[model samples]
Target chain A: MFVRGLKSSIIALESNLKNRTLFFLLNFVLLVTVFIEILTYKHSIALEPHRYQNFTDDILIVQMHYDSETPYTFSSIFDRKLASIENVLYTQYAINQYIYNKETYQLSVKIKGTSGNFIENYDIVDFYYKTNGLPNVKKNELIYGRVWTNEEYQKGESVGLIYEATAKTIFGKSDATGERLNFGSHSIKIIGILKNTDDIKNYYRTFNNYNLEFVVYTPITYLKSDSLIDYSIMRSYNNDILKEIITNNISEKMYFYEREDVISKTLDIKKEQLSNFYYVIVVTLIICVVGLFQLIKNFINQMTFECSIRRTFGATKFEIFSMLVFQNSFVFLLALMLAIVVSIMIIYAYFYFSYRYVYPYLSYIDINIILIIGIAQLILTIAFTTLLSQKIINTNIIDGVKGNS
Target chain B: MYELINVSKSYGKNQIFTNLNFTIESKKFTGIFGESGSGKTTLVSILGMLDQKYTGNYIFNGINITQLGDRELSTLRKEKIGFLFQESYLINEITVFDNLLLNVLDKENKQLIKRIRELMDKFAISDFLYRRVSTLSGGEKQRVALVRALLMNPELIIADEPTGNLDKTNSEIILSYLKSLCLENKTVIVVSHDEKVLKYCDIQYNLIKNGKLERCL
Candidate 1:
């Protein structure tokens, strides 16, 4: 039966090369899309700074919330405790204004205020320098300038600084580095710019569908009694010690942790995106299957007389059914292969140009997707084939042969 | 031998034919004639065992063919029956040789190839052995279909308007081949409207629109 099927199938295939090519291309594309998503997720996670390779569980961030009715301000409650993490430091920043004329942003942005220790603690020394120009002040000047150096904290000088980008926006493109931009009553000079990393860049820069206005950074000493900014930053000697500090200081209602917490949260974000992706594939699959089913139905109807001829020649119902299924699957296999190939090429192009990573971050193939779709296609093909097969079987062979006449 | 005892067939409410009786003994050439919708094709289908949705007792070589299951019926047909249609129904994607080979089951490679080559030559379609059915002329395709039917050398041959699509010369050629196969002790039943095919038959029946069967002129 298989040999007979193979022979006729080869014949059918030879006669329909165009459709075969198109079908395989479709399958290739579906595979490539999934491959890229999985690969990109892993790559982004790998690029994070960690104590171990793929160390996705080490650190977290904690936020302590105060009851609004309790007559206590977040700044008042958070400031003292945050300053005392042994060998730790702190920062507080706000979003007083924004500039989003050109690009969109998809991720969120947060700013911190601190004594100059905020720079060393976040390990963003270069970022702090690039975003602000240079932190320079004359003696007894009381010059309000962006804190751009680790040396300032050791010297113990009280200063007022503004995030450089915000200063440039308020003062235009001129030398905002030395000019004081007033935040409420106190004025601060912009010193340097923040260096961009992929994760941080995505947060600040424009994506296809989102925009992040802008962030303001200032010294904790300069913060006023009344401000809307709701976040604070804490520096710790190590993540374990930080976790202990947060656990003691914050309530159970307030979540606490380190960088791993961020990664896990990011993973949840990825999973949500993945579920939406799954929905797209499923919907496309359903549409494709429905379209293909109609095609098979039409082909069988047109070939009804021929089926009867085979039946008249002693072709059994199963044989006829097998022939139809083999024919359809042959087309599906070709389409699937083509889709996979094309999809791979597109995803490869994306990963190659952006990261310059040699090995595919995506495995280039996901067998799970294939297995799932394959099983689905098999069941659908068999079910449809069986329905059409029974139709052939129920046909009175005499009328079928004569029907064509 | 094939015998149809009081056979009846209908579609929902349309009774095409009922209580029709006939017998086609072995090794004889028989012809069934009728105009359009006269049900001659339906009777042929019944005798060929392709139309099972009918009330009838079909006995073949003293066995009840009507009672056979799909597998049994198919096995019986493959071993003991072959058919030729008016349009030479061959798969257009395959070569003439492969078309014939399609009916050949899983057998030793050498034997299968040998049999295919022999049949291709015997039917005088050897020149078209590698030609796809779509590329062949009407006459060539018919000859190929005929050769395909003969490959298994079944006991019964049911041809429906076998020469309906041919020119006069090709029609004669096909009729001559059909006659020769009858001489080989195979039950050859040919259905046609053209009176020209009657010359090659030993007995004939004309199926009237009133559902009556009478001796052919």
Candidate 2:
């Protein structure tokens, strides 16, 4: 019986061009709404500053203007006695650099440079592992070789440490200590090989300019200092007061990227995007309902005679309902499929054309929300048509047939 | 095979049947005659189980129809009866073949298909089988309706003004088919204003006279 209705539904769809177009429009609105919602949610989470791997919440990343050749050296101003409040643990900056391995797989790994071991002292490895949703990851341990002394970093030595696997891929050995690991045209002496974590596949992830997959502390002189941002971890008895003091004392000329501030701003952005999508949904629903009512009016005018004929010929009322709903359902599903394809294409075209860090955030989009929306739309349509079709079903058969005469 | 006791039906201020009692016997051609406003259509609808909203008890094949719900009444209409109406009453958009198959589309099989072919052949409408109903002549459409009415091998057939749109020749052809069903032990009730067609009925009723069988020549 449903099959019969389905076949008739196809014919019904083909008969009315207005119905088909309206149906498509209604479904397109729903599909675009859901896709936009998912995109906004994923992009908001991705835009969160934690992805930069800033493990030390006690830190403030501040960048000031600099000339290409003259990077500002972190020195106290004796003229203002600024040395009284100087608590910079280390002067360092990190930048993202792409590494193409032997297989030509490009991975964006952070190149961190520091004047001291501020990274190891604050349990950077443990913090990154914990933030990455793994609580039991091993602590940062140098499997081989010694750490570069402060003198080496101050003298601008071109030296670094790498994860064991990264070392093997670079120099064909896990223990590549004392060997030169060539990155682009520059060679860094492998002073240490950090014990690789299980999640080396996450080399693309960064924690506040620190590579979560491989911890490579090179000399500051090796990095393009002008393209880097300076970050310093403040130490004080009360961390909140120190953060407040630093925020107040920092020059307005510096760009501040405080984690708390960034997180809050990103959340506001997420909320704004969600509210925009909701408005789109409401506007589309209103248009769709108006269109549906018009469609129902047309159905009553056109389908009354046909339904009467079927009823007179032995089709039960329920069978008539099935036929009607299936007819509309056919058009609804077709529109839904078209909307899905179009929404995906739109997202792809937008993302692929942008020069920013592109991620296929759609791949990890939350699907339950989409399903809920689809089901809601289906129920709304079915219920609306059901109420109207009931009138035709319960119509006086004699009057219906005779009225057409 | 059908009985209606004290059935009174009204459409708001307009009353159609007022405390009318009627009965139809099995395997007979019953003709119901009445004036235009005397409610011949309303009477047939009640007999056809299409209109059950009446103040009466209806027993068909020994089941109380007045007690049945819409679904049950619909099942009775589908299984035990068939209907023919004036104005061709065929779905004009679909093909003749599709129109015939609409009611039995779910149970369509070799046997049903062969029966449909045989009926079309018998009605001399086999040539127009695949043509759309909208394109068929009035006589051709009525013949198709006749074939559809008997396709289910129903126990009862109710037709209201079945020949109102046909000419003399076409009218005779349709009336002859209704008469022939009686020989096969099938009951047929036809409501028509034509005295010429009333001559073919084995039993006759006058709805204008409080739903009594008139026994008219």
Candidate 3:
């Protein structure tokens, strides 16, 4: 009996291919929505690890502002207190640009002075350097932030590394390592070049009125200035304690910044995105349920005579209902398979294109969640189709056979 | 044997039949003759258990059909009664073989297959077994309908104008087949307006004025 009913259902479905195609297309919307939700979830998980690795918990930036009445220096009691803390790794004082000059064919650029352990403590190594070796700034030598040829770096020449954008603007070329520039009263020769200037631009923009990419880097003693220190960046395992100690010891004119503040803001934005996605999913599910209910109701109305004919042939009401359910279930399964194939192609194309441009790694989907959602959709389809079929089957069989109301 | 005692049927304010009485016996071909709105089809529907809105006592083989539930009536119809409508009403998308085997749920029975093949051969429709019903001619469709009605070997066969759409020759062919079923101790009841079909019946009835069945010579 089951086999015969199944064969009849298949024939019925085949006879109405046009309607089945429309049905499949309508149901495909639901599958696509669920697929998008899964992709979004995977994307969030992929970005989290990268963000966590970049923004570790041990770093903090202390921005100090002082007027002439209360001048702040790193070698004062505040630094001594910070160094006394047991969890402190180290501290590095950095001076923002203190000099600025521009002349036709002979421009003098401001050089930033820092301690020797500045690069090691801040974990800033992945820049593109012109030479095979990076210049460890000591005493009189400096590293330029631009690409340079090997001939530019001769054994004992006084070299100052200039930023790539500054080199390009001043000399009309990027590899200006062999060029000479004047800073205040001293002349310096360019050496190895750095590829990017975003970090320099940001640091100068914080306190200086001029935002120039032609900045140079040298040791604090090379600058020979006592009041050029802008701020100090410290690394410690316990930033909350460091923050408390600095806040207590510093004068009322100074302020401190913590890296956790940036991390918290980024986490807030991600939370908002996830909350919005939940709303979208709920709205989509409601639309799908209502749309499927109406579709099944109309289909059952159209097949009333067919149901009556089967009933006339000794099919019980349940048997007639089961046959209709089987027919539609076959259509749903076919649509689901088609939807899956199309979704895979779409996801693959999106990831492939994005990998070449923006995102580096391909995101992954959780198969368990997909299977659960698929099963839920199947249950919704069967339940709605069966309920509507039962209602139509309860009508008088004679009226159906006679094609009457 | 079947009997309808004081059967009454109506639709809203319109009355189709009222207090009508009739009896049909086994081993005979009976024809109910009526005009366009004489309620012959309605009477067949009542007798076939397809219409349960009538107030009456329907006794079939010594059981009160009126007291039975829908499930029992369905089983009785499935096991003992077969129906043939004016339109062949076969599912047009399926083949003639599938239409004939439509009511036979247990399709793997060898005995049933043999019986279906023999019946198709007898009707000379073996050539169109695999052809879709929509592609068949009027007479071929009626023959296939007959084969389906008789597939279950029902004790009673109720046909509503089985030859209504056929020609004179095909009408005679269908009447002859119904007459032959009486020799197998099967009761064959046909409702029609055709004098040629009524002439082949062992007993004839005409529904006259005021919802009553009168005997005809």
TM-score to native of every candidate shown = 0.61, 0.65, 0.65
Q: State the lDDT of candidate 3 residue by residue for A277-368, as single tens digits.
A: 77787787677778778777777787787777767767777777777787778787877777777776776677566543324434333445
Which candidate should be chosen as best, given DockQ against the real structure?
A: 2
**Poorly placed runs, candidate 3 (over 4 Å):** A1-22, A33-283, A355-363, A367-372
DockQ of candidate 1 (2 decimals): 0.30
Candidate 2: regions farther than 4 A off: A1-138, A141-281, A293-301, A350-372, B209-217
Candidate 3: which pairs clash?
A: A143-A161, A144-A161, A144-A162, A145-A194, A146-A193, A146-A194
Error of 3 at A314 (Å): 0.9
lDDT of 1 by residue, A1-405 (tens): 668556666754554444444444554444445444544444444432221111211111111121112211224223323332211212211110111223321112222222211211111010111223232111111133334344433332223343334333444342346554332133344453332223432432321122332233333323334222222323333445444444454322132212223434555676676667666655666666776566556656655665676676667787777766776676666655654555456556765676554333244234365456655765776677677667765777766665742
Task: Categorize the docking of model 3.
Answer: acceptable
Model 1 TM-score (2 dp): 0.61
For candidate 2, write residues A1-405 as lDDT tens digits. Answer: 667545655544544445456656756675675655555455445433323222122211111111123322222110110111112211112100111113222112122332211221111111112111111224446788865665664565677666677666444468989986442234468787778776533432322233333345444334433222123322232445434443454322122322224434555786777667667666765666666566655665567776777787677888778877776666666666676667667666665565133343334435456556556666766776798888888898877777732
lDDT of each: 0.56, 0.61, 0.63
DockQ of candidate 2 against the true complex: 0.48
Q: What DockQ do you compute for every candidate structure?
A: 0.30, 0.48, 0.27
What global local distance difference test value does model 1 have?
A: 0.56
